[model samples]
Target chain A: MAQTFSASELKQIYDFALDLGRRAGRILIEGVEKRTGDVGEREEGGVGGGQREKMNAVDIVTQTDLDVEAFVKGEIERVYPGHKFIGEETYSAGSSKEYLIDASPTWVVDPLDGTVNYTHLFPMFCVSIAFVLNHVPIIGVIYQPLLDTTYSSLVGYGAWQDDGKVGGKRKRLPLVNGPKAVLPREAPKGCIFSCEWGKDRRDTAGGNMWRKVDSFVNMAAEIGGRGGKGGMVHGMRSLGSATLDLAYIAAGSFDIWWEGGCWEWDVAAGIAILREAGGLITTANPPANPETDPIEEVRLGSRLYLAIRPAGDSEGETGRQAQERVVRETWKRVRALDYARPGA
Target chain B: MAQTFSASELKQIYDFALDLGRRAGRILIEGVEKRTGDVGEREEGGVGGGQREKMNAVDIVTQTDLDVEAFVKGEIERVYPGHKFIGEETYSAGSSKEYLIDASPTWVVDPLDGTVNYTHLFPMFCVSIAFVLNHVPIIGVIYQPLLDTTYSSLVGYGAWQDDGKVGGKRKRLPLVNGPKAVLPREAPKGCIFSCEWGKDRRDTAGGNMWRKVDSFVNMAAEIGGRGGKGGMVHGMRSLGSATLDLAYIAAGSFDIWWEGGCWEWDVAAGIAILREAGGLITTANPPANPETDPIEEVRLGSRLYLAIRPAGDSEGETGRQAQERVVRETWKRVRALDYARPGA
Candidate 1:
């Protein structure tokens, strides 16, 4: 079951994905702008699987989303035949947690990660493409067309970002890049915390939605709450775009992105870039210290994640210690309710 | 005291503010980029009034904020010798609420609205500038240099936006412009809700922090709470930029912006844009209808505002009715705990 591709061959595939992702992102931005004007008259209800147009309060699938998935799938197949595809718009039903069990080269794609934002013309959506080999996200690319920024990473090669405003120079993650580590500040003090309330508002107790609300309250509560342990974060932000959330954390703009109830495609690209940029991704479950846990223990499709940006340059031992202390202290106060479905 | 200026004179002042705002925004952006790199090692404590370096859990004041305010004030004085000014970085202590009572043509400015975000390099800060005559915001402009987008409006002239993308075309607001009005959908049901956890995190009951937590929980709660009314919004967003929040709602991207614990300068510019775009601004307090009440009833300096985007064209009486119904229903379920201090 050993992989047959050489390092050079893997690099070639990574280059292919980076180019294809950028092209698909441009298509998404253009299509979204053209379609935003007509959203006024579009009916609210629909159903979907393959371009199956479905609409709901939390999630919506537009033709553009499906089209982008198909286009990316087609492009990937053209470049590398026999590579399996797992895309959001056409993801198989009842494939939770075990979808990545097949040990083949798979291209995981969330052609439009933030479909809800895309529909609202919120400018927070993105195209997330990742190449997974042996269940590992080896190559990842996330392109945000509105911001004209692209984040990409090849496993072991490190993460990089190309911002349109900076003359499209590909800045290696942490801004300083290389030998310099980029440490994050303590939570709720100087940190910009990111999370989302996914569209799963079941009224039942211990439900995913219920837990998210509880967690948000706890994270935002005052430092010393009335007879409670409040995380007292500096601020809370929900931009409605998960891929960008992970990408931003990787880029050092956001200190942490805690998410749950999302699939593998939603985070694969971001996870790859994050790790490459010297960040760590762990379960959102509270009291779990990111400093001590090996990131390899992080379950890919656990539907929960707590991603922390790298502490600044490796040389500053004190700064790095402070960053880790924040992560530990923040986790001590966080209590994310379990979202695992019954008998999963 | 009736205003002495004619319509033409007011237009001239508005034009000058727009030009000044754009120039000031560029300077802020340049300064921010230059300063973001050094934030890593900058000592995290200081005190502030006029460029008094200060740091706190919620608010951070950098030199750039004070510099930008001074630059804008200087530019305005050179253009009109006697116009009074009230700006965030320079406002007198304890005069936060009553600074706008003067009947003169006063320029209200928040040189940097999202100081915390700016300090964190989060890109949610902006330059908010408004010209108020007789305590009425007659012209407003909000510029986000990071995105290079500008939202501006002159009373009676309507709202407009110039996105740095799309070849910098100055598209009129409401997106539809002129005859058509673009309305927002119902809240917590496909609606994008925006709010902020401002820097008033006093842990005491009935304090700003306590009240914000209560409101957020209520808004995000299930439609039929166990024993209480729930706002049940589609999703919640806290981008930490009040000016951008109001400007985005005025531009029709955000459906609603519910804010409290902010100042007049934070929202005056956005109020002008919202009104000019046919949107409605009312108190964040629930059960108050903007339709029956005069726009003047919107207490600008009250530090509490609830703004809603219009629903499409006015021709469809049924559509307009539906829009109003949503707002009314939303208000009924909203219960923002009062944060005003006793005998203020």
Candidate 2:
């Protein structure tokens, strides 16, 4: 019924998938610059919440958002009709929230990575898609249309981009320099760090977010001889786009990025892109396996990821140790808002 | 004796000084593209303890950085040489602590802002220069070399910039789209916000920088519709440079921006630029005039500032109310962070 293929066949499939990502990126870029592609309020259609649930503070959705998901889903279906395809809007619409993620070579698509930035005409958004076989991201493509940059990665093959844009194109996501740049150098002590303003208010049960932000900014001010107190991080930035944020880390454009409260669709494609760019993605708490499966870990929402561009070139073990230190220090700074999460 | 001049004469002086800001910006852009600037690290001359004692950052001190500062200072001196000049490197080299602000019309300059980005070839930094009269930012000039963006503002001149870059041919900073675009909206349940990470940390005594970051990010997350639990403030972002971050708000690129640990050099000129765009800048707590001496109540060394561009351009009465609401809401967020600064 389905056409099965060999290793070469898989390579061809990946190549085609990469082409599709580029094409989609072009379409998105053209759409953004056009006045016609505006998401004006639909006064014509009565306000309906079903089509778009409150994603969070400062975020909204629409049928078009869902339509983009469907478009990508269909594109994958048309190419590899037998290959499993999973996307966000469909999951929200369907009864199964599992995403049906299987090891049997699936394509993960996040049609719109930063919906909030898109709605507001902010330029730090992207379209992310990943192809995986045996639960490893064999091929990944991430495109930020507004910024006109696309990042892609393939298993063992390595990660790269079209050219320098958004977060620079890199062999590894960050392509971080050596000891003078990475190890022995102490990770610059102070620099620009990134993360989104996820939920979990200090007034809530999941107050870890509040604690993290507080410690982060304070640390940023004091760190790195940037003119404040600490030299741990110079600055902390959040661009509202997981795809672009993670891309920044892989490209070595940004030093580090820690995130939580995101779905697989939000980070799946970027994860591969970052890893390919010589970056490491780890957990926020224990700081392990940034590439760990997005399973429901304590919370059912279960989508948290921490990505960093280590200074080491995988040969040296210092980067790993630096990452470990960062996590421990960050945890020490966090003072749990709600004390509900297990780690707290 | 200091040469005495009328208030309008002071305004003329500001005009001439801002002229040099644009010129400095041009040179900076060329320097960046050509990478043709010379970089020199100072010999670690000054010895001051307490905090600046442990400097862990390596700044790219270049001719471009100094040339711009010197040029701006020269222009000011040519018009009124008696006025003092405070710059990033000059301040530390000359004085151990800080220069006197005793009613002197001082020019604070940060030549070649975003040097790290400039060196690494990222394009988000700019040149910031502010004219402080007796403490308040009387006039300011900010320019992003690459973007050809120049913002000039005086206490009463209403602030403006040269649009589309016609070789220093200045024009009133046009309000984007609607006049409201120049104004700060009610931080829609889901809007885009911007901030920066300064050199602050939890380890520093009496400095709640860590808490500030946590609260700020949490506000972005918790402000309503999507990521957080109840509220929505759309999205949050942080571009590395404080001047550019403020300029973004003035250009209606961002709704609100909050920062601390950033020196007056980073934001003094930006504050004028934001206010010129009909925005509000004030202390994060105690809600007072950030333009004057209220900075003392602002938790010394912790430079907390909140700026909100008013939407719907109503400066007479309603505009004041809009400014009040923004300040209040910003205060509310700060309070949230303060409570969470030490961590929840």
Candidate 3:
């Protein structure tokens, strides 16, 4: 049986996660700002200004990433001694890539999401913190320092965005005044689609990279183009951060987010937030069996995710049915991508 | 000969444009907010709510767009009676699009750039205003109301970003404290590239859509992949706003912006701001003759543009040379595109 927490206990954990996320955000902002300053000095011909040669863009592991992860891990351990912790930095450090999640009170954290955006000073990086109990995420908090925004949610409770002002009012998710609109009849054709070109860039035939590019083109082409596989989405946005992509979906700004290859820490917090806002998540690709439900097959460590925003009842269809319909439509345009977690 | 304005005259114009942009932004905020509310009501099953069926994403012309343009045009005409004006809404409404620019003082404006984003409630839209004299952009101001940020510049003067606070200090463009860094030796390899899918989605063989997707794939694939034409860029971002993309280039956040099929109004303000920050603008496609300079071949009316951020100096090479070198390298990977203005 799944363990459950009282509402009061969940609130306490959510509060702690929000605080921790903000602390991690400060570290990210400071690190990126310092790096920006260092780059400026280098351009101005300053010698020995703490500048290190970046080996490559994809492999930019800054001291800040380590620092933020370490700080968050230490705090969680100190505050909740009985809870387990799994972080991106620590997980990557270990050789084992088997499923780290289990039926326990655990904290999954991505200390610095959007590392490339951070390195480039793109101002989209964030700190994501999620608390999972019994293999299910129960609380989530994501803080973007530059934007001074925080997105937080608790199981059985709604999501909210805090603008980080001293006396600012927190806005409820789906930010719309009432129920969310149902998915458009044309589905992806009128939807704003979000995805990422992740770290893997191999272009072998039928490889992850090729499939991802093909999927993007199929979604972007005209409706009748690409041999009838075109989705012709209203817009395609790649913000380089899975956490923010999910947060935007919860905020009702992004209509859909389809991604593969990201780990649990990247989506755990986002998933919690998205779910609280009435959004749904399922497998990126359709199930082989015609009658299988995609949502039932999705796991936290699945690595492939297709998320849709809340769609309330419209045109004689239920909100859930509308979301499922759009998901099926999107799956048709997407070429299947294979991304197995280590030891999966 | 190009007409010149005194520093005092330019400053006054810049201040007026800034004010005009902010005023227009108010209308946009109101319009989007009202629409969000209306949609909420419709979703909640409220009867007779103010809702209209949108025909398509590319052609979402909200009343806000027309209102902002009318207000800005009226304000400009009132302030500078002798100056001419060309705006996105007005231009689109007119049947003729033959080189609207002339060697005269004029104001080119996109009252609402990123119309799709705005209609979808994405916060990346902005009001762009540019002042041109003798076919040269002299002053530019772009206001993003959602972020409460403003980017402005004057020819021969510096560019600045105002955070929209009553007493907030305006930061200088290229926001770094010192000189800007030169392009990476690997050119687009370490660059953060930004582009738009645009309104045109025609997919004929070798058409604009195919060429764009091919170019994007080439830029994103691993180096030495795609038959030795891969760029392997660090990150790819599509914010769905041409104006903000160029402003980000000026701010040194976005390293490169390669776009085709945008209008003069979509880029005039951003071009002035970027040039003031020491950035470069050139043709997106290579010139036929190897000896021809891409920068020299580019004109204000050119539908294709490739822009690079300010690069001060590095590794014994001048900033100009570094920029030119990157441009040449990028050209090798781009597929030529054709986008002619009507009646051109």
* Steric collisions counted per model: 18, 70, 0
As a whole number from 0 to 100, the lDDT of residue A204 in candidate 1 is 69
Comparing to the true complex, what docking class would candidate 2 get?
incorrect
- Residue B141, model 1: lDDT of 93
- Once fitted onto the true fold, the runs of candidate 2 whose alpha carbons sit more than 4 angstroms away are A1-83, A161-175, A184-192, A205-232, A287-302, A313-344, B1-64, B67-86, B96-108, B114-123, B129-197, B202-236, B287-304, B313-317, B332-344
Give the candidate order by descending TM-score: 3, 1, 2
Candidate 3 global TM-score: 0.90
Model 1 chain A weakest lDDT span, ten residues long: A45-54
lDDT of each: 0.70, 0.57, 0.79
For model 2, what is the C-alpha lDDT against the true structure?
0.57
lDDT (Cα, tens digit) per residue for candidate 3, span B22-69:
899988876754544323211332211214323332233466788899
True contacts kept of each: 0.21, 0.18, 0.31
lDDT (tens digit, per residue) of candidate 2 on A4-41:
45777866766776777666656554443231122222
- Alpha-carbon error at B222 in model 1, in Å? 2.9
Give the top-scoring candidate (TM-score). 3
Docking level for model 3: acceptable
How do the residues A1-344 of candidate 3 rate in per-residue lDDT, one tens digit apiece?
65667899888998899889988888876664454432321143221122433333223346889999999999998999989999999999999888889898999999999887776666678999999998888799999877678989987766777764322446666653232255778878888999888767887987998888888888888899889988889889988899999998887788889999889999999999988878889888766642445556358998999999876676678778888888888888887789877644
In the order shown, the candidates' DockQ scores are 0.23, 0.14, 0.32
